[model samples]
Target: MYEIVAGIDKSEDRGRAIAESITEMPLDHGEVRVTLLHDFQDNPEGASVDQVASVRHARKILEEVGIEVVLEESSGEPADAILRLADEQDAEMIVVAGRKRTPTGKVLFGSVTQSVILGTDRPVLVCSGDEN
Candidate 1:
């Protein structure tokens, strides 16, 4: 089975994009497995990955099509957590969503998506979060 680690954030649109991309891929129902990951930098409320709304959204879409999905949670740096988890899981691919950002904005904010893409040797699937 092909294993994929999808690092989903709080954005509903981005989460949907990731799920849609996976659905559109030409894979058999049971041939692939997706692990939905949510890296929480700060969770005072103490939430699980399955409690995340975006994760729940993605899970629904993937499960509807008979794709095996696992929910995971981690703390600390998002990119680091995602990559480390992917390595531990021996995932075949990593999936992440990126928003359209101005060059200046990106430089100032620093992108977790960019970090994940560059940090991994495994294939990365980037889904556009921009609706337009």
Candidate 2:
């Protein structure tokens, strides 16, 4: 029953899987609040309506499993948004999706997963496509 916050994004499958996996974990006490945060870049056209709707729908599914969800939409960098939300929530654990990259690619692009791990004080759980 630990207070866990999950950072979700455009990847629906991976996000849902991460939420589901967190739900399955054994916690001792507090309730788990799964937050789905999407950072929309500032643009003339504004954010995609369909993307917002999709995240809302995903929140509904997670809510069904007894996970209290807070859906957030903001304009900023992904890593910054995630870290800010995690701090605001006082999350015991921060869960996010891990990107698969070759050694060269990881070195060049710099990994978001790595960034989160280094930037946050909370334990970061990365759910990848191949993770069991």
Candidate 3:
């Protein structure tokens, strides 16, 4: 089976697309299992809400294609939490959905996607978010 860890932020559209693309990938002779991860920094109340929404979105999309799905919510820096979980789970691939940002912007704002890409040796699939 394919073990995928998808780190979702505020981009629901791009996140869903990433999940769909992964689930659709031809698996030769195995099934796909996805762990939808949403890292919530302090604020438990708001974090719970966001986590629920993210899990719901991932479940709705992944389940429709008959892919097994689960939710993982953690506290800490988003990128760090995702990387830690991926390592712990030995995920085959890491997924993220975020907007494109220039190097200067990324440096200034500190991008979670970029951090994940640079931090992990695992293959990272980044889906561009929809323009809003």
Q: What is the C-alpha lDDT profile of model 2 across 1-132, one tens digit per residue?
A: 456666666666767667667766775223767777777765467765235654665676767777777777667677888888889878788888887789999899877678889998889888874434
User: Which residue segments of model 2 deviate by more than 4 Å?
Assistant: 28-30, 42-44, 48-50, 130-132
User: Could you tell me the TM-score of candidate 2?
Assistant: 0.80
Residue 40 lDDT in model 2? 74
lDDT for model 2 comes to 0.72
In candidate 2, list every pair of residues with a backbone clash. 1-27, 1-30
Point to the candidate with the largest TM-score. 1
TM-score result, candidate 1: 0.95
- Candidate 3 C-alpha error for residue 36, in Å: 0.3
Task: Write the number of the candidate with greater TM-score, choosing between 1 and 3.
Answer: 1
Which parts of model 3 have CA positions greater than 4 angstroms off?
28-30, 42-51
Best by lDDT: 1
Q: Taking the tens digit of each residue's C-alpha lDDT, what string does model 1 give over 4-56?
A: 99999988899999999998988896899999999898999998988889999
Q: Once model 1 is optimally superposed onto the true structure by TM-score, how far is the C-alpha of residue 48 displaced, in angstroms?
A: 1.2
TM-score of each: 0.95, 0.80, 0.86
Error of 3 at 95 (Å): 0.6
Q: What is the model-wide C-alpha lDDT for candidate 3?
A: 0.79
